[model samples]
Target: MSISDQIERLATAKANIAAAIESKGVDVPEGASISDMAALVVKIPVFTEEEVFLAAHPVGSYFKTASKGDPGEIYGGRWELDPSLGAFRWRRIE
Candidate 1:
């Protein structure tokens, strides 16, 4: 296929995947996981240990972490920031 045709196909696929996830009432942060996408499954992307800390401690001048190495680790493949608790909390991907 031509480069333009390939790009169009990929874009269409992405939109379809996103629409399918929304229909199932799921939210994908950043982007949907690749493995289960074709199945229209809500596969939440698992973050690396270091990435968790970085997210919790966003590097903007105004952002600060309560302490070092304290983004709270992801459990069961998903991590959510709980403002009420002021910490990262484990949440189910499915």
Candidate 2:
């Protein structure tokens, strides 16, 4: 799915679920939707090879090996630039 589709899914989730997002003991202002949260968050899927590594190291491995390891046929995969990571992250609406 596209970013737009993911954003829409997040928006739909926001409509269905209510959770408080706070920083420094203050809640973020309204109009900040789940899509905004999703923008701030990125999900890196666990592939078969990475599964063992992830099981051993729950935190995550280096991007180079992680990207190359057992990435079986990514159907409808896309990438988004993560400014903090200074790299493109794979994104797919699972």
Candidate 3:
């Protein structure tokens, strides 16, 4: 993929994750990007195991694993960017 494509994918993943968290009633920082959230997740020492896993592989490794049909793919269901909203929304493929 081109650099632009990679960036778009990363942004899409971040937006999707942010939306998911908010759907669960968590208050994400206003306008905070995924990179910001990952930084916080990594520094905080009291995250759940799943949180740690997500934080540890926020981008590269996460996408790689997902492509390989691994846990990363299962964690967030599936996502697509919503251009109108300027963020990603999750959907179940099934």
lDDT by candidate, in order shown: 0.51, 0.43, 0.55
| CA deviation > 4 Å runs, candidate 1 | 36-94
Winning model by lDDT = 3
Ranking by lDDT: 3, 1, 2
- The residue-by-residue lDDT of candidate 3 on 1-94, one tens digit each, is 9999999998898888877666655667988877777655543345577666566544433232113243535564343322234223322331
Alpha carbon deviation, residue 46, candidate 2 (Å): 36
Candidate 2 lDDT over residue span 1-94, tens digit each: 9999998997777754334334223343467666665543333233575455344433322222235322224322233322335343433222
Q: Which model is ahead, 2 or 3, in terms of lDDT?
A: 3
The global Cα lDDT (0 to 1) of model 3 is 0.55
| Best first by TM-score, ranked | 3, 1, 2
User: How well is each residue in 30-77 modelled by candidate 1, as lDDT tens digits?
Assistant: 565555465546354556766665555443312224532322343222
Clash totals for all candidate models: 0, 0, 0
Residue pair clashes in candidate 3: none
